[model samples]
Target: MIYKSMLLVILLLPMIGSLVGWLIGRKSEKYRDKFNILLTAAELLIISLMFKRIGVEPVSLFIPDIMGTGLALKLDIFRYIFVWVTAFIWFLTTIYSTQYLIRYKNRNRYYAFFMLTLGSTIGIFLSENLINLFTFFEIMSFTSYLLVIHDEDEYAHDAGKSYISMAIIGGLVLLMGLFLMYDYLGTVDISVLSHSMKNIGSIKYLISTLLIIGFGVKASIVPLHVWLPKAHPAAPTPASAVLSGILVKTGIFGIIIVVGVIMNGDIPLSTAVIILGFINMLLGGFLAIFQRNVKRILAYSSMSQVGYIMVGLGLIGLLKDHNAIAVYATLYHIFNHALFKVLLFLCAGIIYMILHELSINAIRGFGKHKNVLKVLFLIGLFAIIGMPGFNGFISKTLLHEALSEAHHMYKTRWFDVAELVFTISSSFTVAYLLKIFITVFMEESEEYRGQYRDHLKKRAIVPMIMLSVVIIFIGLRPNVILKVLEGTMELFHAHGSIEPHFYDIKNIKSSIITIGYGCIIYFGFIRSYLRRRENGRPIYFNPSLRWLSLERHIYIPVGRFLYRSSSVVFKVIDRGIINLVIYLSNSLKSLSGIKVKRPTRVIADLKIKKPKELTRFKIKEEHEDITKRLSKRSMHKEFVTFMDMVTVLRRNLNSLMYAVFILAVMIIVVLGVLVF
Candidate 1:
């Protein structure tokens, strides 16, 4: 009984706490910051206490049936894992934000949305039904967009637009897919859907595609990833940390539910995921290589890393009953990436907070002799680049081995392509991390003479140190994470059979090779070919690659086309075709000799009729009822009135932003009926 209430508290406390934080935030930053930290810490304690109570069997808390559908809160081994992951990160981010956002405007608004999103993210992890997952997913999107647009600058607004637009498009696509799912399956419960999904046949593929594309916008799979790179750089540091760290994983978590759980390891969809994932990995890494903004580089790296996670997920489907290794790899990497990525973003935030600049050329020697910041940055760097003793090395090795096993099992060319791309992308990851390190931390004093203040507050350093310590602990004793990962196999319906070995000869050799390739790319090409010395300073020379974006080539054109399409659809199909149908119906009735009148109720007994004043057409008389009907002299006035109304609507229609709002509301309502 106690355990059940704790689960609800874990889900709702952050939300409740965030509201309180907002109210007090207007008073002072100290009051607001302390309130949020306390609330988040309390939520973490609740989650911790519930940790032991969540047994092998799933525990569910139910709300009353809402319009024939019930809301559920289930704590299973799957949700349990992410519950801890999210809370831990949120707690750290809160601590980091306390000092980082000091004196920054809108602290109240930032903390409010921050806490709200924390609750929404946990809800997403704990949801037992798709309706519940999506409900929280929408809340998460709305709250996080506030974080993105918090700076209230033009860049922030632009990124916010892209972020919200992608989220809405994804939601619509997902709702349409889910409508078909609920119509055929009769339920949105994962446990129930998992049992029935096998019988849906080809419909499952369409459903899978829609859900993937929908989630892909957030998961940031290639072609659907234009918003990610933009939004991360625009958001404040802690917000950016969570955005890249955990928000993206919520999308992967949904995909896990669909492909790994509900769909029962659908093979065809798995292949498509693998193909799209490989493309995303390469494209993200390629773009990251040329970026000048440190934050954007990290953002693009997130896309690549997420693609790697997707590849691990795809491998799960291809491996079948042999899916244990891939499942472990994917889950482990999700946690590992969240840890290192958050640390890196916070470290970047510290640099930004101090230096007020983010370009590689702008901050050369930024970490000079700052041992704490340097060491902290290196820990994340090594972890991200897959150093032999870091957390990333273990996961990437497992991921590579899993793909290799799948390839060997099938003897197919595609798996070979997967292996090759994974290797190349890994090398690129090393290259960029090395580039940052070389530019910011490793230049000789003679080469770069400028230096800035490096002394940092303990508030900023503590959270990063905590993250670095965890990354190293896991890197050294990976069995801890490997054990946690074993619990996730039941969710994916896989064997927790194979014991993972991180320090083996094969793993070590692969790490060495990947790191060596990364060094070569950094020193040979990036330093010499892509950068040039101008007036005794190093300048990045890859403007072509930096500006060459999918936004210009693909997303903008598609967005414009969609806007134009909606107008054409409204004028030509909605009004034009619908009006034509009514005309045809009336013409058919007349031709068939059936008198059709507008259906209405009128008095048959009462003798009410038009007044004589209305019937008398006295055009010269001022009281000719010209306001009620168009008398001959008032024809021009009536035409002018009608034209004014039409013109007003037409002028407003030029904006078309309302169409987007209406379309979004309509989709939500439609999905609401299917769920609630």
Candidate 2:
């Protein structure tokens, strides 16, 4: 009771206190900021106190039937650690945003939504059942939408449109999945479902697909990641930090719940996830290199990082014996990615605010005189690039080793290829980071050097410095967090026997190899031709747009087509059937009443004239839509050939289909032999 009470207070405080921030902001901005900072600080303190009470077993709170479902909340070791992370991050972002948002309007609205988002995110981590998780998930989504569109410009509005579209579609699909799953199981209890739903037949596949789409949109894996790049650049700096830093992680958290628990770590499911992860990783890394906008690069990078985490989730499912190590890697990377990615975005925010520009070309040499921001940015850069002594190094190393172990256990060529792709993506990562560094920091632009000035103050950088310090500290002393992770690993019954050799010779050598490849790519591509040609010349590398944007090529067109097609089909089937029934009934009544004139010929019957009013209305409001006619044409220009795309999809889909078909055939053959 004591633990539950304390836990409840920590979870609910930020949201409830948001009212105070809102009310205060309406009356006085200063008081609102102070109140928000105090609320975050107090929430952190309370969470720490609550953390002290959580043991091996979880502390639980149960509410009787409400909202068509029961509310179940628990504070286990994992939840406690995540809650602690949430409070800590919320506090830091609050402090950072205070300085970041000083010049922006709606300071009060931003602060209010900020706290509301914070509370809902914490609530997600604390939730013990699906209903509880989704309730908070929705609140987090809607409140965060406000944050995304805080700027209220056309760009913000468009980005908000993209963001909300994905969110609503995902949420509705996820809701249907939840309803189906709960109807089948009669409950949304996490513990019971993970343990019992081992074989729900083919419907499990449908449920799984729904859940993945629901969560993957936010996770931004491959075809579903259209909104991230646009939304990140459109949002305010502080909101951008939170969006990349923590908001995406909520989608990831839902994914973990679905894949890890609901699906029971099925091998086929895991394999499918790995393939998607690898695709996103490659595509995101490939796309980031082409981007000039600093925030868009980071947004794409976030997509790839989520890919890394997804890979770990897949491995955990595949290697149940070592689920602990895999789960630990996944959780650890989520934390590190949040840290460095948020820091990177915050750095961008400060740069944008200081110079009133986001284009790397425009901000060239801005970091030359700003040593502190430069160093902090480098720390974040290195952390993300998996440099030897930053936080990302630890998580990346663990995942690489886990992948190696899984490869050893199953020595297939596909695993070998997957490892190769993962390795090269790391190289691509280095190439892009070098591009950002060289363009903004190293390369000199005389035009912008004179125009640009350092405007970020000391207080604005407090968050960056703090994050950098923590990242560096964790890189050096990973055991500090690894110890907590190992405990959480125990709950999953995963193999987490840590050894010194992990960070020793082999992994060190591996890290050196990755960096060496990165170095080669940087000089070979980024430095070799692109920079060599850019000395007071009109030379720019053309980033081919044909395959660069999945959203444009696939997600948007396909999504709109499906939406329109489904609407058309529903209208035709439903309304057409009703209208036909009405016409037939009226004709039958006319015949039965003996009131019909001599029967008209078939041609005459079919040629009934339109109403005079309808004909006049149609002619008066005539419209022409060239684009609609264009859609009737071939979808692709010569460059965007349809057969080419179909061929590629067929190739990839064939491999997956072959695997499933073979697996099914094996099951069938075995069943036949057994029955005979």
Q: Pick the candidate with the highest TM-score.
A: 1
- For all candidates in order, the CA lDDT equals 0.79, 0.76
- lDDT score for residue 82 of model 1: 80
lDDT by residue (tens digit), candidate 2, 1-676: 7878877787778888988789988888878888888889898888777655665567898887965667788887767666777787778888888888888888888888888899899888888888888788888889989988998999999999989877876777677788888878787888888865666778887777777877887788767788999999999887888888788888888787778777877888889998888888888887887777899889989998888999998988888886667887888898899899988988898888877688776676667666677788899989998988899999999888778878988899999899998999888888888778867777655554544344666656887888899999999998888777766765565764666444687787888788788878877876665553456542335355545455566556655555565556554554444345334444554455332232221111111222222221232121112122323433233222222222233334434544554444444432222222
User: What's the CA error at residue 338 for candidate 2, in Å?
Assistant: 1.1
RMSD of 2: 13.0
lDDT of 1 at 47: 77
User: What's model 1's TM-score?
Assistant: 0.86
- Lowest lDDT sum, 10 consecutive residues, model 2, at 601-610
User: Model 1: which ten-residue window has the lowest total lDDT?
Assistant: 603-612
Q: TM-scores, in order shown?
A: 0.86, 0.84
Return the top candidate by lDDT: 1
